[model samples]
Target: MSTLDAWTHGEHTHDGTTHPVYRRGTGPGVVVIHEIPGMTPEFLAFADEVVEAGFTVVLPHLFGTPGRPVGAGYVLDTVRRVCVSNEFTKLATGVTTPLAGWLRSLARELHAELGGPGVGALGMCFTGGFALAMMVDTAVVAPVLAQPSAPFPVGPTRSRDVNLSPEDLAVVKERAAGGCQVMGLRYRQDPAVGQRFETLAHELGDAFVRVEFPGRKHSTLTLHRQQEAVDRVLGFLDEKLRA
Candidate 1:
C-alpha cells in the first residue's frame, strides 16, 4: 500500500483554485507543501516524521504524480508544467505567487480548527519560498523554507529574489519585526538557493533563522535526508506551534 493511503484525503479551494490535500496526525496544524516532481515517497516520509512528532500534518499535492518516485523524466515534466502555470512566479522577482493565497487560506482554515497560537507552514525546493509568502497571514506563525529554488535563480536579479512582491514583503517585514521568525535550511554551496538566504537575512534581519548544512545537497529534509535538519525542523515546529 502507498504511504498516502494512511492519510485522509481532501481538497482545499481559494479564489476558485482547488488542490488535493492529504492530512494526518492530531495536534497543532502544519502544512507541508511538496517540492517539484510531486509528492515522492521521501516527501511523504518527511511528512510522516512531522505527524509522529505530534502535529496534524497536511500535504498539498501541487504537481506531478502522487506516490511517484523521483526520476529524471518525472522531474523534467513537472518542471515544464510549473514553468507555464500562472499559479507560480517561476522567474519573476518581487512578486508573490498566486498559489500562496490558497496556501494562506489553508493555513487559516487549519489554525481556525486547531486553535493554537498559529499554524506551521513548510515548503520545499520549487515551492520552498512559499512558506515565507504565506506568512502574510497571521495564521502562519512558523514558516520554514527548505532549499527555496524560486525565480529559477537564472541570473543575478532572479537569483537574489525572495519571491515576494513589494507589498507582501513589507507585511512580512512587519511580521518579522513583530517576532514571527522564519526558518530556512539549505546547503552553503547549493547554487539553486542562490543569494535568497542573504536577502532574507537583510529583509527580515534576525527574525530569519538560517540553518546551513555542509556540502551541496539540494533537499535538506528529503532526498538528501539530513537527520540534523529533520531534528531542527521538528524542534522548530514544536517550539513555535506546541509552545
Candidate 2:
C-alpha cells in the first residue's frame, strides 16, 4: 500500500469544492499543506514528524501526484496545472487565492473537533502563503510559511506582494494585533520567495517571526529541509496550539 493508503482519507468540502485530506496522529490539530508537486515522500515525512510531536496532523493534497518524487518533469507538470488553476492567483498581485477560504474552513472544523487553543497550519512552497491567509479565520493560531512563493514572483509588484487582498490582509493584521504571531522561513537568496518576508514584517510588525537561513535553499521542510526550521516550526506549534 502507498504511504497515504495507511492514513485515514477524507474530503474537506467548502464553497462547493472538495479536496482530499490524509490524516493521522492524535492531539491538537496541525494541517500541513504541500507544495506544487503535491505530497511527496519528503512532505509526508515532515508531516509524520509533526504527528510524532503530538499533533493530529492532516495532509491536504492540492496538486501533483501524491507519493511521486520531485523530478524536473514532475515539477514542471505540477507547475503547469497550478499556473492555470483558478484556485491559485498566479501572476496576480494583491490577491489572495480563493482556495484559502476552503483551507480556513478545514482548520475551523479541525479545531472544533480537537479542542485546543486553536489549530496550527504549515504551508510550504506554493501553498506557504495559504497558512497566512487562513489566519483570517481566527481559529488558525499558528501559521507557518515555508518559502511562500505565490503570485508567481514574476515582476516588481508580484515580487513584493503578499498575495492577500486588502480586505483579507486587514483581517490578518487584526489577528496579529490580538497576539497571533506568524512564522516564516526562506533562504536569503531564494528568488521564488521574493520580498514577501519584508511585506510580512511591515504588515505584521512584531508579530511576524521570520526564520531566515543562508544560501539558496528553497523548501524548508523538504527538498532542502532545514533541521533548525523544522524544529522551530514544531516548537511554535507546541507553543501556539498545545499551550
Q: Which candidate is the best by lDDT?
A: 1
Tens digits of per-residue lDDT, candidate 2, 1-243, equal 136766898899998999999999999999999997888888888888888899899888889888887899999988988888899888887789989989999999999998879999988888889999999898899999999998778888889898899999999999998899999999999999999999999999999998999998799788898899999999999999878
Compute the lDDT for candidate 1: 0.93
**In model 2, where do residues sit more than 4 Å from their true spots?**
none
**Clash total of candidate 1:** 0
Show model 1 residue runs off by greater than 4 Å.
none
Q: How accurate is candidate 2 locally (lDDT)?
A: 0.90
Error of 1 at 159 (Å): 0.8
Per-candidate local distance difference test: 0.93, 0.90
Error of 2 at 146 (Å): 0.3
TM-scores for all predictions: 0.98, 0.97
Clashing pairs in 1: none
**What lDDT tens digits, residue by residue, belong to model 1 across residues 162-226?**
89999999999999999999999999999999999999999999999999988987999989989
